[model samples]
Target chain A: MACFLVPAAEAVITTVASKVMQSKESAPETVHISLDGSTVTEAVKTPFSKKLKWLNNLLWGGSALLAFEHVWHGEVVPWFPFLSAASNPSDAAEMLHEMSTAGVTMAVLVTVVWCGMLAVSNVIENRAVKSAALLPSSK
Target chain B: MTLLTTVFAAIICTIIWYRNAPKSQMKIGILCWMYWGASLMWLVDAVFEYAEIHDEYFTPAPIDMLNDFYLGLSVVALGLIIWLVILLAKDPKGVVKSVLFKKKI
Candidate 1:
């Protein structure tokens, strides 16, 4: 019933982590010096913060949709304990059970998918770098 | 049924993302990923619910089906709203930025 809370909690953590990482992250620059003594600096890659943003976006979006679904079914409400199941001791226990089971499962599944996406993204970035390196230099 | 709805939305978004090609300033990729992830989550939920309910899972009441359809539509709308907010905030193509900063010459 309250499975969305798991991903929502994860999203909150990642969003904070992303902001912290972004603050600490500096674009790694490559310096190139020409024979004429002119030097140029350029950032060579996307930062980890940006990649974390992809995961944040996925988690937040999915959690939002699931939360809306729960709200529609009246499993979630606006006040007090918030979750309808929390109003009762037995239902609260069941809610916790669902959270540990389905909730955790969904969160892990999304994270695994995100990991796969990161792997593919890494491959794409590598390919782009390779192709760019293979190109004839303008110099 | 909700799972199917999300899967359909994901497929449609993916197609649109591909059609847009190199123009990623709008970040359709984010929306596609959202729907895909939601679809996957719901698929797992469906599997679990099926295991719990067995044959009843195949025979959800009409009212429940209708409610699910409504919920599915609302989720799609919410996703679009979230994407729109991101687009407006980022002003990917400078559409909002250009309008807001248009100088009086």
Candidate 2:
């Protein structure tokens, strides 16, 4: 019933990680002189934070939607013993079971999809780098 | 039914993204990813539920189907809202910034 919590938890972690990575990344250079005596700088590579943001967007969006579904079904509530399922011993047990099975499966599937996106992005970035290396600079 | 809604939304967003790939600054890609990911999640949910319920899964009550369709629409609306917030905050096209500055001037 509360399967969305799993992904929500993961989203929280990734959001924190994104913030930390952003802090650690170097500041942009203020000035650059190109090989052709131009002052323009090359396009900077996409930062790790931006990639993490893609995952965050996916996880958060999915989790929020799923949570809304649960709330609609009255499985979740605002007050204490937040999950309606938690109010009953048998339902709570079933809820945990569902979390372990369906919830975990959903989280894992989303993460796998995110990994695929990362792989595609890496390939594109590599191709761009290769092409840029082969091309002659022009003023 | 929910899966179908998300699938349609994803397809529409993908088409829009493709058409404006050159000069669009709307960041429609984020919306596309969100809908596609949710569609995949719901697909898995449906598969697991189908495994458990077998024939019953095919004949969900009419009321339940309506509820699901509404839920799917709400999800799409929520995604759009989030994307709008991001777009306004980022102001990729400087539209919001220009409006605010124009007000002051």
lDDT over C-alpha atoms for residue A33 of model 1: 24
Report lDDT (Cα) of residue A130, candidate 1: 52
Residue B81 shift from truth in candidate 1, angstroms:
2.1
Instruction: Write candidate 2's Cα lDDT for B1-105 as tens digits.
Output: 888899999999999999999699999987887887788778779989999999999999999899899988988998899899999999999999988886634
Q: Candidate 1: lDDT of B50?
A: 94
Best by TM-score: 1
Q: Relative to the true structure, how large is the alpha-carbon lDDT of every model?
A: 0.83, 0.83
Measured as a fraction from 0 to 1, the native contacts recovered by model 2 come to 0.49
* Model-by-model DockQ, in order: 0.59, 0.56
A1-139 per-residue lDDT for model 2 (tens digits): 9888887888899999999999998964332224233233465667878888988988887887778778878889999899999998999999999888888888889889889989998887666555555555522
Q: Which digits, one per residue and each the tens of the lDDT, describe model 1 over residues A27-93?
A: 6545232222233223356688888888888788788888888988899999988999999999999
After superposition, candidate 2 runs with Cα above 4 Å error? A27-41, A135-139, B59-62, B89-91, B94-105
Q: Candidate 1, overall lDDT? A: 0.83
